[model samples]
Target: LHCGTGKVSYVGGNSKSPALFISLLKRLKATYRRAKTITLIVDNYIIHKSRETERWLKENPKFRVIYQPVYSPRVNHVERLWQALHDTITRNHQCRS
Candidate 1:
């Protein structure tokens, strides 16, 4: 997802979520192909430290992860997006599988 100022992307779940991170890298590449480097702000999620992810990062020198401090939701701007999304979709909302 993207806020007006900058983009906010994420990968969730467990080790099975590598695909999400891969997709996010693709988006970052496409979105900032001409830029020198792309700075990514993220939480300290364990999957982010997986061997696969580490390998990908090792090869992709242009990409960097800036980890947010633990337990500090207020420092995460992406949480603002979640708050806004929640406020906008109040009541009668359901996730259909």
Candidate 2:
């Protein structure tokens, strides 16, 4: 869930945030028309293994979800993006809502 900085918060989540992840996917696919396969790298969360999600994955082989091992946030590029956003916000004192 990548979003431009604003009043709205775009959230990318780990296994702990299933609803947010699913919601982000819905938002992404709503207007997306490309036929290319989607490759996703994520942390291992229990929700990724949910029955419903698994069924969806089976039905959609074009979407690939790769789960990284635990305690490896440093390897996730989203962490760097968040850090950059934090730095930009803190430098301007405009992070708080």
Candidate 3:
């Protein structure tokens, strides 16, 4: 999300692997291709720290990733936004599918 404009960039539909993560990062980079750099705050998942992920980061000098504590939900700034999203979208809903 852009702190100044509240612009959020989101994407999905890839497997939980470093290669897919790199693809997602590329998509995000496309969103701000002109910007000098992009800093992403993410949780410490195993796939994030893999050799493949490291290689991708090495190749992408303009992108940076910050990892928070493994078990601390509060450390992630977007947690509140996510909770609100669930409450507003799925609360009191009946799903038959």
The lDDT leader among the candidates is 3
Q: What's the TM-score of each model vs. the native?
A: 0.71, 0.56, 0.76
Tens digit per residue, CA lDDT, model 3, 1-97: 7777888776554358877777778888898899898998878888778898888889999988888875566678787777787799868986554
Which residue pairs show backbone clashes in model 2? Answer: 15-45
Q: Per-prediction count of colliding residue pairs?
A: 0, 1, 0
Candidate 2 positional error at 73, Å: 3.1
What lDDT would candidate 2 get against the real structure?
Answer: 0.60
- Those runs of model 1 whose alpha carbons end farther than 4 Å from true positions after fitting are 1-4, 7-16, 90-92
**Total backbone collisions, model 3:** 0
lDDT tens per residue, model 1, 15-80: 456566766786777887997987777777765666777788888889878888644668987767
Error of 3 at 35 (Å): 1.1
What's the lDDT for residue 47 in model 1?
52
Using TM-score as the yardstick, the better of models 2 and 3 is 3
lDDT of each: 0.70, 0.60, 0.79
**Positional deviation of residue 22's Cα in model 3 after best superposition, in angstroms:** 1.5
Highest TM-score among the candidates is held by which one?
A: 3
Model 1 poorest 10 in a row by lDDT: 7-16
Q: Where in model 2 is the C-alpha error above 4 Å?
A: 1-19, 83-97
